[model samples]
Target: MTAATQPRSVNSAAADDVAPIVQRLRETYARWTRRTPIEQMRDDWDELFRSRAQPWRINGFEAGGVAAEWIMAPDARANRTILYLHGGGFRMGSIDSHRDLMQRLSIAAGARVLGINYRLGPEHVFPAAVEDALSGYRWLLDSGVRSGSIAFAGDSAGGGLVLACMFAARAANLELPSAACLMSPWTDLAATGATFLSRADVDPLHQRPMILSMAKAYLGPSGNPLDPLASPLYGDLERLPPLLIQCGDCETILDDSVRLADRAAKAGVAAELEVYPSMIHVFQAYGELHAARQALASAGRFLGRYFTEQDKRPPEGRGDTRDCG
Candidate 1:
């Protein structure tokens, strides 16, 4: 679609608009994961993006018959908490790979983030991830953390989980967070987006057939891939908190975020969508990328509005220089 026709703004001259650093990132991801197996892909991710931040304490907890790592900022006693879910296509990724993003988010949101290391698929499949997410939220509530002060965030598959958790939470009559944010979220696990094929050549990380293979592995012989919990784009979107979604224009999964915004808007949920030109999937992982910095700054501004701070002024009071767009 042309930039003018799109629901949100787009830089059509993305080739020239994108920074050289992002170009290098595309090259790096292509070189690193070319023809690699899913397991090796996870290992490579660990080797490449592993956080060097000093290890902080995470109170271990059990939920839904699985163990989860809950990382808390040292000053969490006063600040609020965010429950973060890491994305790896339901078969990969861990809290360790997402540490940097979570740390940045914690600082931006003025809250301690609890990153959950949920169980993967091919062995645990479908409802397992959703069950773990609900269990984690329940644990947070049961532990005396006020629900209104908690926010949910995630990327890719984790993004889908955040929405699923919202669905489950509403069903159970739990209090919701003030707002939420998603980065390059894979809302449609069914891989039904036209971009999956249209942008195949440009998308660096994901390929349609390969992702379908992984989904099959996770679902096994008798699983429904289009189930709402698995593909939350197919689920109900009403009653969700205000949500901000950041996506890259060039990624194969771009349609996932687009469809989500459309669905959410149709359901009357407050949704703000931002699409960065010529950006790759989860480009925020490369902190040096200009688009990554822009996306993070956008997320920070959005969070700052919803997550009020005791000493800070309201977003409107902040100078216009901080505007994301």
Candidate 2:
């Protein structure tokens, strides 16, 4: 549970290294501003990143009276499947914005990743997203995929959803995944992390007040923002599968991942937490960035090891789950 050694800065000219991309992203945000309500931001993101290479088959499912798209990797036939949850502060984002990342993950895990376009908030709050995530998990299980062979992965809010699903599975006495991975999870939606203020200038994407507003919108009047299922860092972690968490040291949510790992370890869960230095929030979106590529490489390696181990382990009841647990 101790912190991994901080990665060295990739370049000395920090401003020169990030300014153009940041500026471009800012301009994109401005353009999004012109189109109000902000929920439509996912549409803009889907359009802007539409050219990214992600060849997948689309399937549909019903949740909360809404149809959700499941994007599955085309190459998958017999390999295991990963159910991916997309992150957008529980408000914006879709399967498309995360398509490239999930494609890489699908390739790395040697499995098809099914990315869910879950219901977002201010309209569908709290358990709405949680229920949709579980429904997606159930769909995978019902489709004949062994639960132990399946994995859950996500980034930011989706990362949080990953933990939520695991907790729900455990509570329901259902089978858990062989492994799970998260990228800078927003685990503590209550905005308890001090980094929100101290790291504001350095962290990109999440400005504290903005995230708080989104959190409030997602929680609604009946929900408790601190409920462990809502804010997973505060949840029980024992009996969970091997966990892989990756975070940028520069993000406001940095502490969320760090603390979650520490707590998971304390609760006897096997956890690996990697912190990439000087990277912004969900930097993996910038596949061209050096740090992003490195992070993905690390993720691929970790998943390869876990999947290989899973392949060796016999089925539960036939063999001890405790060894892998």
Candidate 3:
């Protein structure tokens, strides 16, 4: 093959390697969505997500006085911390289900990570998660961690909570964190995004019925999906910290990241969005995959930019940057 075609050929081979894994995941998602009970799903997740190796010295503690767990690598970086939120469509998910992902993130970012076990829906409802997220931030501040040294990160519904926390912090006049990173963020709880239908076939995990079900479970009869706190896509994004959003083109919520970046830019925040080809929602679950590993490393570097003391200048207008992988 000519030199010009070499890169394409290698990429093609790498993609082929990932195809079987994606197919297996898609099949598994379909099975779970069809037959799994909501309560049982938590246990199912615990069994499904097994860590290959432990990278952090894990411990449970009261973060800012709220029940939380901290995962720190052996040689952790100083003055850097990540407050992570786990995703389960607001109804499920816990620190246990997300430990592996958090461990990988801690290793990649070289920072201390706090995974807060926020209250879930069907019992706590809309503002409960919001309240917990804000409280976690408050605890972080009370613990003497400077806002500039911290970053907020999450996946799916937890990702939405990250944005909600930002809004809450801004309104409360709390100093904002240095940056934020969202993975396959379910920003629009209303399930109105075009990708919900367009990418339905490609995304094995989420479906219209399940998506709407989760929305109702979280919002209840009184909650409004358009409330910026609940659905951040409708929120004011002006003056927010720099944001990095990563999503797979095949995800049902792909537009959530896309429009979020656009809205953040229109409001003048430095936002970067990356759309990975042939990947599904939260593909970072497969740390073994080259694409997922690359995505996580990129995410680490993006958050690190803000954590670095020397790069704290105010972001400029319409930093609407996009990258493809």
Q: Which is the leading candidate under lDDT?
A: 3
Better of 2 and 3 by TM-score: 3
Task: Estimate the overall C-alpha local distance difference test score of candidate 2.
Answer: 0.74
In model 1, the worst 10-residue window by lDDT is 316-325
> Which clashing pairs does model 1 show?
none
Residue-by-residue lDDT tens digits, candidate 1, 204-268:
66799877877786666777888777778998888888888888878898888888888887787
Candidate 3 ranges with C-alpha deviation above 4 Å = 1-13, 16-37, 53-55, 308-325
Q: In model 1, which regions exceed 4 Å deviation?
A: 1-7, 10-41, 51-66, 70-77, 308-325
Candidates in order have lDDT scores of 0.73, 0.74, 0.79
Identify the superior model by TM-score, candidate 1 or candidate 3: 3
What is the Å distance of residue 228 in model 3 from its true position? 0.6
lDDT of model 2 at position 192: 85
- Please tell me which model should have the higher lDDT, number 1 or number 2: 2
Residue 248's lDDT within candidate 3 is 83
Q: Looking at model 3, which ten-residue stretch has the lowest summed lDDT?
A: 316-325
Instruction: Please write out the lDDT profile of model 2 over residues 268-287, one tens digit for every residue.
Output: 77788877777777877777
Each model's backbone clash number: 0, 0, 0
Question: Clashes in model 2: which pairs?
Answer: none
